[model samples]
Target chain A: MQYLNNIGTYFLMIIELFRKPTKWSVMRHLILKDIDDLIIGSLGIVSFIAFFVGGVVTIQTALNIDNPLIPKTLVGFATRQSILLEFAPTFMSIIMAGKVGSFITSSIGTMRVTEQIDALEVMGINSLNYLVFPKLVAMAFYPFVISIAMFLGIIGGLTACVYGGYSSVDDFITGIQQDFQPFHIVYAFIKTFLFAFVLATIPSYHGYYMKGGALEVGEASTTSFVWTSVTIILLNYLATQLLLS
Target chain B: MIEVKNLHKSFGDAHILKGISNTFEQGKTNLIIGQSGSGKSVFLKCLLGLYDYEEGSIEYNGEVFANLSEDKKRDMRAKIGMVFQGSALFDSLTIEENVMFPLRMFTKLKKDEMRERASIVLKRVNLEDAHKKMPSEASGGMQKRVAIARAIVNNPKYLFCDEPNSGLDPKTAIVIDNLIHEITEEYNITTVINTHDMNSVMEIGDSIMFLKDGLKAWEGSKKTIFKTDNKIVTDFVYSSNLFKKVREAVLKEQG
Candidate 1:
């Protein structure tokens, strides 16, 4: 019954989304804002994670390859698969949810508890459409851009591996070229899009329903971040099974 | 032009509003006065359809609000403008953008046209030069004026102000009160202000409804309010030292 009620609420929200044209405009503003935040806010972290993880993975994989019969090229294939299929979508979302999702939830939830949402309602504007829709669009689009960032980070790590005498640049490129399938990239993109939606929607919903006062808003933000990160991980596993299978 | 009949609202076991029924007339400043927990804000929210009342009917110009479809309710909402307590201005948008928000959302007005309408309303609230500034940059009183401008930019038929003068200096509070009153008269809008300010009651409360613990204790115009012998009403009105002194002076003259 509770699950049914949640579905019903989501359906109502979607219907409300279509009813207002301003929601689209608001969504545009939110998406642009998210893009800006992702660039300025998430860039350093993504680069740090990507560069270090890339270097560590390549080094560890190189050390583990003791069998002279096993091709040294297999290390690059393994790293490529890990970065594209798992690391970019899963770890990046965790980081983004902690940083971006928390900010979105707290800011919007504070507005909700403060009667700002009611103010919009009284002005003949739909607060959900104005507030949530923009966030939805932003989260949906920005992750795809971040995936590209993650891809570059992987390349940077591979370059470091070559400098460290772990693998030749030609061998690394050859391993990725031979093993990297279009479907892996597509799956990564799809997962990131879904992850973004969950991140934005869950937090916005929590914030939109926030009541009481500052304490409640704080609790909502914390809950949104925790739930969204968990949801993203769970969904990533499910998508991998469903799509990769 | 708004009538709330037998309104009752409860949060789980605790009842907030107990059968509140009142008529807010057109082209008049109707005030709801109460202490902090008297449920005045809840009553206003109930009227706006923000709070789902367990039982009651709100009729706006004879249209039942609860029975109306979402679209119809939205149409009614568009016709109503509200100035929220704490200003409630959008932090992300500039003052001009905040004022233009409803115009852009509700109407298909061109950008230039929306700007024109926003400017007119901003000037009406005496905020002609603060358009580019964000809500965070504005003073508390200035923010309240911007909120008023945003509320009235749509030229709504019904104006709802939830403690419009809250958190402002006395002079600024009067300015806001008189601005609401003047707008109510000029637009012939049905203006409902929720306040506990005694000075506001005297200045522009053409009609006043006093709520005590979620029940309507008294309903009368400002003129009759002074003559009321109701102890609760007197206690509230004369609670201020200035008003207490004035009341004593008047009684001495009579004696």
Candidate 2:
């Protein structure tokens, strides 16, 4: 019965989200407050993953073929597929789930345990709408922006490849141009939107239900990040199979 | 007026409120007093619909509040105001914005009208120039006053306060108690307060309900408290060493 109730709550929350999405001002405020944290915390990790993953996949693909019939430049095609489809969106959300998700869960859980949520309820404000919706909208939009940042990290990797004489700039660009499909960008966005939803809702739900004092709030944040990261990885595999297949 | 009928709440196996019933009249300070973990706050939360009781009904102005629909509950909640125990002010908002929040959400009043109303309530709470200050900048007593301003800014039909004087110094506690009493009389609202402060009970307790171990052990006015022969009531009222000595001295003088 508790499980059923939780499922019901999720559906109700989704409906609530649709009924009154976050106000523009509130979204703007949350975004500005979190921008520095998101960029600083997520950029380095994503940059490292993007650069190293791109170079490693390029190197591995180039070594696989013994015959020179297949262009060695096709290594860049594999790099492009890996970066756009699976690496950028998934890796960024996993990193962000640790940074932004934990921040939101702890902040809101503290507010809940401190009776701030009750204060809003007494004032006839929908506490969920005021607290969670802004975060959801911000997370939804912000990840798309961060995915662009992830793409820049890929460019950094490409720069390294050119400077190290492993590949020419024209050849790398031609490899990407040959293999790139517009649908990959669409697929990336769909995955990003789904990741954002999962990241925002799971943590917000955990925080909203926090009951005890500071200790419970800390536990909620830790649990939210752990669960959200696991769910992101699991869903990444599922979404890739569904979309790419 | 507020009427609670046979309100029962239990946490798992522990019954918190057992068949508790009371009436809180309008235009007076109706206080619920008890020791820590005695369920006074829980009862107040039940009344506010923040807790779901397993059984019983609460009526506000003769309308049943327990089984109301979501929209009805929301509408009813708009007519209720609360001052939380910790003075739960929005940390991100300035004092003026905190007080102005409900007005902005519930009313289509012009911004100027909302600001004017907020200022009026702030002045009523004796906070005239602290509008621009954040809640963190205010003292504990000042935060309670800001909370009170926010509570009454909407001119609610019912006011509920949970430990309104918990952490303040004696003098400021008295001031807040008096202000809450004055507002209760001025607005003719049904005001319910959950408190353990004996000073508050003495000063503004127009009617008081005492809960002991989650049971309604005693109910009476301040004037009748001293005269009542209930042992639990007497022990709670005169438990302090100083109050016990005062009580003994009074008895000796009477003898």
Candidate 3:
């Protein structure tokens, strides 16, 4: 029942978010600011995690397939498949639910605790539209972050395969190309886009409606992170069932 | 002028405002004073349309707020400006940017024109020299001044200030009080202040409403509050010995 309530409130918030829009001139600045905060600010952590996770995938695949009958190039295939299908999109998004999600929650929650949101509402500004819409628009570019992740992941896998004696550079490169399906990349990005919207809005819901003061802001951020990660996982499962299965 | 008639508000099982009815005159600093949990903030928020009322009407220049369409309500809200207790300045913006925000959002003025208008208000609040600083860098008094500058930058018809002097020194509090008074008179804006600052009450509270436990305990001017025998209003106002002596001296002067 609580889950149902949350889902209902989340949808209602989305409805309110699109109404009474801020002026485009104002929205443009807000979107730019959010892009800077949510996207540009997230690049370093995404890159670090992607590279290391991709390397681990390559090493794990190579060690598990010790049989000579299995082609060494399968290491690269497994690495690319795992990175694109799961690591880059789903797993990295879980990280974002912590990084970007907490950011949105804490900032907006602080604003609420401080009466900044009230000031906006009293000024006739739609605080929801003013605070959340820009994030939704900015998250439309979530693919850019995933694109970086995909690039770094593949590079890290290639480096790992060559240096770790898992496979020769040529075989790994060949494996990456052998059955390269563009649609899988599309599938990954479709999930990325969906999760991006999830990441932007769920935390906003927790923060915007949060009550109490400074301590409550911390609690709200934690709750937002937990809920965002949980929702992303659920949506990932649902999307994969529909898109992949 | 703003008027509230038989106002009542509640949250779940808790009633916060009980039948509050009063008029806050234009061109004057109208104050609502009460101890914590006395519903002054709730009353002010109801007037601002930040909170919905269970029963009653809040009117601005005779336009019934509850009956207005969303568009109409928004239009009414645009005519209002508010100073939050914490000043509520946008953390990301410099003082100048904070003051220019409403103009940037609501008007189509050119960049230079917006800057010029922001400068004019900033100067009005005596914040010209602190324009480039962030809200965090400014003193509490300066932040309050910046808030005032932002609130009036759009030339609102009604100004709502929630404890504008909450964190200021007594001297600075009086300065802020006087500033609001001057602005209210100059713009003919109906200014409503929610505060428990006795200094403010005695200084610029042209009209004062005292609340006790969600009910209107007393309503009178600064002069009448001194002459009245209402213990609820007097006890809260004179709780401190210094203020008690001040009130006794005032009554003696009156006698």
| TM-score of predicted chain B versus true chain B for each candidate | 0.96, 0.95, 0.97
In candidate 1, what are the lDDT values of residues B25-103, reduced to their tens digit? 9999999998889999999999888889998899999999999987888888888888889888988899999999888
Top lDDT hit: 3
Interface RMSD of each: 1.8, 2.3, 0.9
For each candidate, report its DockQ versus the true two-chain complex.
0.63, 0.54, 0.86
What would the per-residue lDDT of candidate 3 be over residues B184-211, giving only the tens digit for each residue?
A: 9999999999997888898888999999
In the predicted model 2, the residue pairs found to clash are none
**Which 10 residues in a row give candidate 1 chain B its minimum summed lDDT?**
B246-255
Rank the models by TM-score, top first: 3, 1, 2
Question: Which residue pairs overlap in candidate 1's backbone?
Answer: A27-A134
Better of 1 and 3 by TM-score: 3
Which is superior by TM-score, 2 or 3?
3
How many clashes in each candidate?
Answer: 1, 0, 0
- The CAPRI-style docking tier of model 3 reads high
> What's the CA error at residue A208 for candidate 3, in Å?
1.0
What is the per-residue lDDT of model 2 for residues B1-255, given as tens digits with 9 covering 90 to 100?
Answer: 999999999999999999899999999899999888999988999988888899889999899986677778877988898999999988888999999977876777888999999999999999999999999999999999999999899889899999999889999999999999999999999999999898887789999999998889999987767567899989898899876776666566666
- Arranged by DockQ, best first: 3, 1, 2
Query: Could you tell me the interface RMSD of model 2?
Result: 2.3
Q: Write the per-residue lDDT of candidate 3 for residues A1-245, one digit (tens) a residue.
A: 98798789889999999999999988899999999999999999999988988898898898899789999889888888998998999999999999999999999999999889988998888899999999999999999999999889989999988999888999999888878899998899999999999999999999999999999999999999998898889999998999988
